[model samples]
Target chain A: MPVASLREVQKRFWDSLAGAAGIVAPELADAVVSGTTLGSRARLGIYADAYASRLIDVLREDFPRVAALLGDHRFEHLAREYLARHPSEHPSVRHLGHGMAPFLERRSDVPRFVAELASLEWARVEVFDAPDATPLAMDHLRAIDARDWPHLHFVPVSALRLVRASWPVHELWAGADPARLAPATTVIRVWRDASGAAYHAPLDARAAEVLRLLIAGAPFVIACEAFTDRTPLEAAQAITALLARWIEDGIIARIG
Target chain B: MSLLPHLGHGIGLRPPHYPRVADGTARVDWFEVIAENFMIPGGRPLRVLEQARTLAPVVLHGVSMNLGGSDPLNERHLGELERLIGRFEPAWVSEHLCWGAYGRYYAHDLLPLPYTDEALAHVADRIRHVQERLGRRILIENVSSYLTFTHSTMPEWTFLAGVAEAADCGILLDVNNVYVSAMNHGFSPHAYLAGLPPDRIGQIHLAGHSDAGTHLVDTHDHPVPSPVWDLYADAVRRFGPIATLVEWDDRIPAFEELVAEAERARAIEAEVLGARRQLA
Candidate 1:
């Protein structure tokens, strides 16, 4: 081949190698494996091994408690297999292997708790990078007549995240005492305050439904109806409760 | 007399240091920020940088300029970088003497360029073009490399000095990278320092490196080692109190610890400046 063509081929080969090891075209893997001077599949194994190892390292850094919960051997095995399937999508190492939790949840053999743990980690990252907005001030609420509370539309802070899981994701993320792990499920609301500290409020099913309704842009009056099944006319009381928590957390952006 | 007179020895700020900087404890005369980190839409990185900007003088050090590459410079990244520089109002903007992209593919690491007349004229022309585009002269820093090309007819130091002189740009002389590359390439760090024109040096860098027994990697994982500090002192003596920075990119310590490292550079600078003044 001409020098230019040869350089092009080399570039293509290396590009294929990078793509194969990332969350990209799998067809590139065969080319990467064959393009090298290894002469055997074992040499190409190094790429696969390094790819899986680097991603597993990223996962272990991002989700240390998840790895601890799954134990070393199981976490490494699962991470290796996960990278082989999903690869990485972003160029930044901060973004690599971020979807490991969802990938695990999709696997039939994986435990549901693993998915919950992943959601918890993802929520933490989301809260950290979420856009900044002005917190809803109590002065606005005081300005409104109490009669308008039912029709009020509450906008939560950018960092506010509502996560409902069959497993106790919050408990796992908090690294709570092992004895408390007996809980089968938990609904959690995670948010970062204006000061950039993260906190999670564990809620019951009724509160979770109310939060979901609110998250879906429902009016306070309509969201309160979901919780009315557990308590009578408690919509007013529940709205008051949630709004107070939101205010304390510096989470509410606006209410009108 | 300095373009960035308020800037002093400080680590290049990364994310792990965000909390410390946000808390307002990482003390130094200034902080160096990777230009790309703040290029994104509003997020914690920009938030922390904006907050830190209030606390200290910040200088923009970029990696993706690709000034020495065959490929055309990415004006999009430069435009975003310019927007960030405006927001932060950084004291100085600096990039590497090497390239990070080739033929449209961006390499995350700074790759060395062959030091020859052709490469020198190519890079110098690009530097002039870049200076014209940004409407300001940017500083160019020497890069750490693991390999050298046989096609090069001139030493990298001479090539770098040529580029600085030809393009009328300043030099952000990274002393630790010089030490690292000298040890790897079997050259004298002192010669590399001696090769540079003192007037062109606008800034200095002191950073830690990993000694892998065979080669010194610019890992920036620990305190500035004794030898690198000695080179930094030598650089200060030669360059005469340019903006000195301590860059720690990995295994970052507490805010106080990074400040302590910067303080070490301060003490060294004081000693070197004292010696230079006495000699004068």
Candidate 2:
């Protein structure tokens, strides 16, 4: 019998993992997959099962909250469908779920909050592994000359991320009961603490605006100017309190 | 000969066992980390690796090198591994003899390769490229195969020996994989062991597998069965004591349980080599 080329063999094996049973290469089935108690189809089934289960298990880890909200049966179903649509592109399993949230968004049974929850969950994984930075402390802020306060630009930590959602995704991430998944417009800050634990905080519109402007390299006074709906005194107070919280949370990498 | 040291006995450093291992009190000679896990931008995994490194040496074993694939090497993946090796300075790095991806599609499992001369050349060239990029030689392990290619003319061990010799790499020699593949494909495990080039054997791996009624899957979730313990004895007797590790990747038990398995490997190796010396 003629032997199949490596390329032909790989395409068949890869396609067979997602394909129906008995779809493996003809030579692999006839001459390669020698049988014992198990038939060749059953042997191939072991690998096929492992391929799906391993990738599905990875998705489950990355989107635990989303999986919890949807339940296991539905999540597994979604995982299988997602795998067919988005075969892993990278060598590492950690990257297999890069587009899971977007994939979840297109599902019919999925609520927007569930997809948003997936986004938050994915963000946490990212922040958990993101590069650490030396955060700016209250002492660092105090060290800054008051004369440069208006011109100061705060550098955010590498792990710091801001995500906007149509639902209160922070509640879901904090283990909110599925029955109470209220759809409220929310912006949340996600970052890793010094010991590498990930935490998320819900941000008010004013706080989100300040963080957005500051993250975009806006000067301190200009960042505070984003609170147009509030009084100047109120905006100043909110900015002061927000800066203190960020500093305490170690989200500010530097203030210049 | 291997520049890698005989690091006594060790277990795969799983995430669930991190708290105990990082507690700085867990007794272990070394920890085997999945190289891909630490090949990340940054986060708790690296932090945990730092903590584990303080306790014992770590070996970076990988599953996705795609050494037997037809496509060109993934430079980005190689670069990430190089950076990781620089950071961890592991005792050695190892990957399977099988491929994991083709083109942009990664199967994420150790897919079987035909042990034909053409494939031997293909994989050896890839291993050479990998060694050049890594700035150090690597060890390639035999994967527990669910299927074999009719095109594979030589036995798996002959292919492994050929690749190691042709590429100038070392053999990791996963013993349970030999047992599992032998059972699944009707090959003699003893022949598989004897066929290996002795000088190239750098490490040995012992892992648990599940019998799925029809066939056994290399699950690495349970205790090492008696047959594998018996096989490990043969391996130590034949290869004459190499660096061995217990791999428990799925449904990992407590750190104590994992450590106990590693200890079992230590005891078995001692018993076997001791008997060998008496016979000699």
Candidate 3:
């Protein structure tokens, strides 16, 4: 028999290890040298096991809340399913869970909140290592000229992310039981603080709308328009309060 | 005799030890960070890495280069790595000698390669490309494998040495991997070591492995076992005090315990080299 080319061997080896159940082809198995204790199949099985376990571990780390809710056995199952459909494309394992939340969203078998919870978890992961920026200080805001306040566009930090879910996923992330939860639209803002700690908070409908505007680089006046349902004084007060909170949370990066 | 500096003992800068590293408490001669882990834009990992570099020299150790793969090199991965090299100014950079990706898909695990002439030339060319792109020679570390290709025309060490010589790069001799692969494949660890040109050994890695009954797996969770320690002593005797690191990726202990592992490597290296000097 002719020796397999390097490409042929890699393809066969990868095919054998790619699936959840490693099915080593006859040609591939024939290529491997069987040891005294472990057979060719068993030897290939180690890579197969590692292929699943290592990726599953990465998913487990990225979505701890989802894992906690699913439990180890079910989480492993879900992770395997996720991996089969979406083998990693990026060189880094950090991006392995990029499709996980959406994958969960597409599955009808999983609880509705589970996908949202995963989205929240993945946002935290994204914000955890996002680009660093100097957050806008409250003193800086206070130092701004009153005339420039309306024209000022608040630049959100690079680490800030807004995850919207149909379910109150923040509660689920906070350890609320999934079974006891009710369907409610939730907007969670995830960001990294100055101390490099990742944190998330649920935003109210009005606040979420304004934050969305701010994140989109809208002028302060345009963002405050999100509170049009309230009186002008009330809207002004709310926008002031929100700005203070954002500045404190280190979500606002700069004033452009 | 090695081209790289003998930077004393070091440990992998894992997440669990970030606080200590950031607070300027975790002290070691050097740190070996997973290059992929720090390839991100910014966060605590990069911040802590900055702190780590301030405290000790750091080497960028990557797992995803896929130097032995058949696919075209991922330029984005290389660009990110080059960015990291420019920013952190690591003491040196290293990657595995195995392939991890095929085409668009990545295994994320260091998959073994067949030690044939074709593979040797292919990998050597890729390593040369990588070295030329990075503008610096890299240290390629051998991976622990559970199986070997029957079509392999040469021993693993020879293939490794051939790649190093052809690519004109250095070798990051992983002693634990040598032991694990030897146990799994039924080869002499000493012979594997002796096969390599000692001058090409730029660094050494010491880690723990788990016995899976059928074979030993390079788990890196447990403390460096006695046999691996013995192997480290042998490595010290051969390579003579190359920059060594203790790798504990999973089931990480406290920072102090991890430091203790590095300290142990220091002790073993001293013992082996001291005894060698006595013989002379």
Candidate 4:
């Protein structure tokens, strides 16, 4: 044998090495690979095992809460299923499980609870590495004139992510009983602390609606007007509570 | 093309040991970070990198450059690597000679490449593109493999030398990989080392491997075994105090234990180079 066709060889080798992909292109595996103490196919099996399991290990680390709820056998089943559906296209293994939320949702055996938990975990992962920025101090807000207050728009920190789930993902992630889960819709805010730790908390519906509008690049007046049916006092109290929590958690990047 | 200095014995900068290194409890001449690990936007890893940099130099060691792939160059990957280089200003950046990706899927394992001229040309072109985009010559390390291609026209060492020469890049001589591959594929480690050009060597890697009776896997989990340490001595005698790094990615030890492993390399370097001086 002289020179192997690089294109044909790689196509076949990868197709065969990827056992999860389920297609065995045999030309390269037939004649190109040399057998040793271990058979050629057995040798390739080592790499195939590593490729599938390495990414599974990455997912296990990323979604420990989901794994805990699903149990090791069930979680490994979903992970292998996820791997078969989504081959890692990213350079880093950190992003290998980017599609876990949607993947879980698409699975017939995976419960809606697991999908929501995976979403919440992925949000935490995104917030864990998002760029850091200085939060808005009270002076930055108080210095503004009363007239400009209504027009003020908040710049949420780069790490802020809103995960809306059909179940209480925060409690489930914090070790709640999955079997006792009630069907509920909740919007949770996940953010990185100033000290670089990640945390998530549930938000009230009215306040969460306001935050949703703000996250969509809405002005303070419009966001506040989202609570149109509420009384003036109730609206003012909700906005005050939201801003206090945002500021305390260091999620507000700027207000102008 | 080599413009970097010899950063003596070092350890792969791992997270478990970050707090100690940042707080000045651990000491090393330098640190080698997995480039992909720190390629993210910003986080504790970047902060720890900054803290570690203040103490000693850092080198970027990547596992996924995919130089020998048949697919088109991943411009996005290159751009992220360039961004990381601009921010960290690593003393040197190195990747493997094998390809980890092809088409859209990345294996994440350093897969083997056939040692043929076609492969040499293709990988050389990829390396040139990488060097041009990054504005710096990078080092390429030979990877350990379980099987070799039947159609390989040349030896792995010759192909490594050819790729480095053609691409005008430096060589990151991984002695542990050489020992592991030599043991696996029935090759002479001495011949492999002799095939490499002395001037092209920019760094050295010392690590542990797992023996499975028939073959050895380059698992950097345990301590450097006796055979690998002997290979390191042989390398020090030939390369004369190159930048050596201890890689224990799995089952990582305490900071002091890792430092002691690095210091072991320092002691071996002293013993090897001292004998060379006396013989001369």
- Among these predictions, the greatest TM-score belongs to 3
Native contact fraction of candidate 4?
A: 0.73
DockQ, per model, reads 0.14, 0.75, 0.91, 0.66
Top model number, lDDT: 3
* Comparing 2 and 4 on DockQ, the stronger one: 2
> What are the per-residue Cα lDDT tens digits for candidate 3 across A7-106?
8888888898785486778999999898779889888888998899889999998999999999999999999999999999999889999999999999
Cα lDDT tens digits, model 2, A1-256, are 5667888787777777866534776655664555657666666677788888888889998888888878899999889988888889988888888898898888777888888888888888888888878888898776777677778899888898888999888888778885777678899899999878999988988789899998899998898787767887777677878898899998998876
For model 3, name the residue pairs that clash: none
Chain B TM-score, structure 2: 0.97
For model 2 the local lDDT of residue A56 reads 88
lDDT of 3 at B198: 94
Query: lDDT of each prediction vs. the true structure?
Result: 0.74, 0.85, 0.91, 0.86
Q: Note the residue pairs that clash in candidate 1.
A: A23-A88
Provide the lDDT at A128 for model 2.
Answer: 87
> For residues B32-55, could you state the per-residue lDDT of candidate 4 as single tens digits?
999999888877788888888889
The CAPRI quality class of candidate 2 comes to medium
* Model 1 stretches with alpha carbons more than 4 Å out: A1-58, A71-93, A106-109, A176-186, A228-232, B1-6, B14-26, B39-48, B64-79, B99-108, B113-135, B150-154, B162-168, B254-257
Q: Which whole-number lDDT from 0 to 100 does residue A134 have in model 4?
A: 87
Candidate 2: regions farther than 4 A off: A19-28, A175-181, A229-234, B1-3
Residues A1-256, candidate 1: write the lDDT tens digits: 1122222322433343345444323332333223222322333343334445556777787778788888899999887677556554332445555677788888888778777778777777668667787887777766877778678888777787887788777777778754567646688888877766666778887777777777777888887787655564566777677777677678788874
lDDT of 3 by residue, B1-280 (tens): 7779999999999988999987899889999999999888898888899899999999999999999999989989999999999999999999999998986799999999999899999999999999999999999999999999899989999999999999999999999999999988889999999999998999999999899888899999999999889988988898898999999998999988988999999998889989999999
| TM-score on alpha carbons, each prediction | 0.80, 0.95, 0.98, 0.95
* Model 4 Cα shift for residue A92 (angstroms): 1.7
Q: Per-residue CA lDDT of candidate 1, range B177-255, in tens?
A: 9998888777899999999988888898888888766567788888889999889888877777787888887778877
